[model samples]
Target chain A: MSSLKKSFNVRCRDFIHAGEASISVQQLLKQMHIDPVLIRRIAICGYEGEMNVVMHGGDGIYCVEINTDRIVLDISDKGPGIADIAKAMEKGFSTASDEYREMGFGAGMGLPNMKKNADEMIVESEPGCGTRVRMSFIIKQSTPT
Target chain B: MVPEYISFVEKFCTGCSQCVRVCPTKTIRIRNNKAVFFDELCIGCGECTRVCPEGAVSSSISVIEPCMKDKLNVVIVSPVLYAQFPGVMPSDVLIGLNEMGFDHAIDLSYYLEMFQYAVDEFVLENRKSNNAPWPLISPICPVVIRLIVLNYPNLLDHILPLRRPVSLLGDEIREKLSHEHGVDKKDIIIYHITPCHAKVVPDRSGLMDELGFIDRALGINRIYPGLKQKLEQVKELELSLFPNEHFSFVPSTRGPLWGMSGGEIAGMRIDNVIAVSGVKETMAYLEKIEMGLFSDMEYIEFRACTEGCLGGPLTAVDRYMAKSTVQKFIKMFGIGRRLPRHKIRQLYDKGWFFSRIKPSELAGVYKSKRKPLTFDDMKKIEKLMSLIHGSDCGACGAPDCKTFAEDVVTEAADLKACFKMKE
Candidate 1:
């Protein structure tokens, strides 16, 4: 048809099946026959945001929205907010544990890759409050096969 | 070896994505919520069958059952096929093949005598040219040929310039039947009673430029028992197993040994020869041979199995028991007492297994046949490529850049593990 919107509330601290939830979200958008480019954008941002919640967030939720017009993903965590969101967003500046590093989780490129791949990206975090990240993607109808 | 077309049943597919995940060529697409197979790029390895959880993957092997119309079906069995019948006499199996729609059933080693002459001539030419490498690998084994072509392609030029044994034998049979029986060439089906599945992988998947070689494969393991059962109903004519054909190629007491280690070099009189039968040992030899580690050798034979075809997993015999039996047969037949002069010399004139290389052709489906990638499609493909790490580690099982990118674009694979950034 035209455009559709889909949202998902990704549990903040679920580590075991973290990627599984995003996979379903990605597959659902794919089944909807959304534009390949838009689905990719949604997927890249959605996965990064979902992973960021599980890896870096305190206790909050992440949401994903998809449609024919554009796709949007929003994630908020009430963890120790990034005192320096700029530093956190830097490609290699990571605050991750050895376990995260062993699991290939904390290269600090999550925010960067999200920004690089998505058409729009926004992040807001308070020092004591929480962090909320929203990203958007343009529906390049034929972005992928 | 040519592949028979396998029907793609979309409805029966569970969308479990096993085929997509295991296909060596990455030719499957998950489009419109179903897994669609693209035959153009398929190598026909049946990797999809091993991966399918639903057991939905099936081959069109039954397509060869028609016996090539009312025409005479002459089947040539490799000597090692003796291992297929276990305790049964080879003549009994020959009778079985005769009952199984075969007008003529002959052992391939008979034709091999002639085939050996061609290889000898090819080696002579190789030495004269001095441009080719020593110890020219045998093309008799299609799997070894494919491995060289696909993996060790640099050694392609060194392969012996002779038509494969079966193809040569096919040509000779065609000519004789055409002249002797005055049979129209089209009315004859020359089937090589085979053991390995490579015989089933067609000479050309339309992946090559030339016409495909051979008509069909009848793996002895697949059809021999059925024929054996059918032989029970036939008139009990104790037909001669060893036909009145003139003897020329009397190999060692180890006739089936030709299917095993030391079979090729020892039997063919290619002195300074070394042969490895099984896969592991052959690969190890190839490594050194390709690297020029071995020298002063006239020929090298690699069978991809220990003790060669006698020890083939498809063979129904204990290895040592079969070897001893073949030894006994050789001693009883007085095979080692004398050598048969090579009487069949016309094999040198036969043409090679002809096929041209394919480069980024997508099995020749160009813009004329299939639509060209649109700019939008290109951008999408690039987007998917970006999803991949570009390392091209073959983790997703697609070999290189374009293939992996294509898979991602087709939605046959997800982009997460490939490009997901750690938090």
Candidate 2:
């Protein structure tokens, strides 16, 4: 029933500081002694989400919530939102510019990769306003009674 | 239980906390003016042994001296041994060991070549099938194996299945001597001239110990003096008398280089392989790999030692000098020997080199006895963290303030231990 929450700031177009949030989250999960497979899955989703925010969104917030039974990641960005979520979810459908593409930033696999690794994923966006993504992973019962 | 390979001399320890700072696993703590090690948390990287200026940290030496008097002792010299003597060829070192009363001295390079062939074929097949994990990690360094077992269990499958060349050579030597020479298996003792203490762990733990080929591990520094004396005498002998062709074991151009960092990947035929050395570097790279990065890499060779085995804590010579000597030997002994492809293929089919490591075997090694933290525990830790100054001074015996806060909350340490609290 008890849950812990932490948040990290992600700056748009900040290639240098990208992935820092996910790395911190990964380290925290390791310290909590979570199952390595679960940690890796969460790490992949966190990384993909952070990269998405850096490339597509304006300034954003990456947050994590942890409890005995599950972990949830909420990433929200204030930028021009996607007009068609379904098309954006398709593979190889990157809207990244040539500059970002050359740097290997956007291959259009970000949302799909996150979805693949997370047990559940939800996306909400208003084209003129902003976007938010939520991902959750179920933690197996590991703590002794 | 794994044997205690590293020892702390209480008299020599100044409690300066250098070892605690250098320990990759944070297994050491300065308690009561001496360094104490938690056996379970130790990955045996020997970083403390290198950093302890007081010579407080020392690896356990060979116990085979008394037992070897009656046995047919055969020494298996690590390639790092040959690099220790700047001018002496590996054959001379073998001869020197013979003079030092060993029945036979075998160079590990022969088995290193065999290991390379097997790995090459295995990589090729795995590439074609794409069934196994990509970027298979080298299993040569026991410390690296232990690190994966403790910290990165998810990457356990990334370790190559082949038995380490030393283990393979130990088995082959024991079998050959007992079967062909008619020596009793119990009487034929195998002493590994080890460059590091980590090599001592595998002989006692995991799948590497199932065969029980190696009887003991002798540090290079321990045996250097006697070998050097014999080498001085052997150096005077005519080069033509013990020519390269006359020696039973001669390494190929690439085999001896295996003791150097990046040497393993250098010999591999694959193009997408990477080689990383040093504990910190390996750990950082592993973090990246766990994040699902480097998908295109076919292989990765990681050595816990900075300059590979030559820079091991037990070595007597400077790592840079040893590296140069290894290079000189390779140049002198240009392209010496090769295992026939057919022979390697046959052994590969028989699964002769495969060694499986089960992560389940290492289950409790890294586990904490305390129960998982609850919401209240987290809130308490966060509050304590805010109260403490964030300077990571090791005066509290913990690695950093964050660890100190966790320890205090877990009842592992007292809040009074924080020197800053008194001020």
Q: Which candidate is the best by TM-score?
A: 2
Worst 10 residues of 2 chain B by lDDT: B238-247
Residue B220 CA displacement from its true place in model 1, Å: 2.0
Measured over the true interface residues after superposition, the C-alpha RMSD of each candidate is 15.6, 2.4
Tens-digit lDDT track of model 1 for B45-97: 44465456665665444334757667867776667766544455656666676
What's model 1's TM-score? 0.53
lDDT of 1 by residue, A13-34 (tens): 6786565545555545533455
Question: In model 1, which regions exceed 4 Å deviation?
Answer: A1-145, B1-55, B62-69, B121-131, B205-214, B230-237, B240-255, B276-292, B304-412, B417-423
* DockQ of predictions, in order shown: 0.01, 0.57
Error of 2 at B390 (Å): 2.2
Native-structure RMSD, model 1? 15.6
Using DockQ as the measure, the top candidate is 2
Cα RMSD of all models vs. native, in order, equals 15.6, 2.7
| lDDT on C-alpha atoms for all candidate structures | 0.57, 0.80
How far in Å is the alpha carbon of B318 misplaced in model 2? 1.7
